[model samples]
Target: MERFYARERMGVQGSWSRHSAARVASAQALRGRDRLRAALSAMGFRLQ
Candidate 1:
């Protein structure tokens, strides 16, 4: 896990399977097309 943070622009991608999140818009944030995927999943929606 230590090596994962060794990159110059270190960041985390994907959802936290064991936790919930609430994201807000910000300039530093990327274009997350799958951001709502987790919420949809909790509501019983499946993705391809």
Candidate 2:
């Protein structure tokens, strides 16, 4: 029981959790770019 609490307090967040955060952030950035491209195309403007 004490060991569990010690690990938690040590900030051992694990690679899986860290990877999840990075994946979510990247996904959000990709979504934002796609939205921008769609909006620009809707206005008859070329995104490239």
Local distance difference test, each candidate: 0.51, 0.62
Model 2 clash pairs are none
Q: Report the CA-based lDDT of candidate 2 relative to the real structure.
A: 0.62
* Model 2 ranges off by over 4 Å: 1-33
Residue-level lDDT of model 2, residues 1-48, one tens digit each, is 346646777544456566456645765656576477778889999756
lDDT of 2 at 36: 71
For 1-48, candidate 1 gives per-residue lDDT tens digits of 334444544554544431124343442342464467877888999977
**TM-score between candidate 2 and the true structure:** 0.31
Question: How far off is model 2, as Cα RMSD?
Answer: 10.2
**C-alpha positional error of residue 34 in candidate 2 after TM-score superposition, expressed in Å:** 3.4
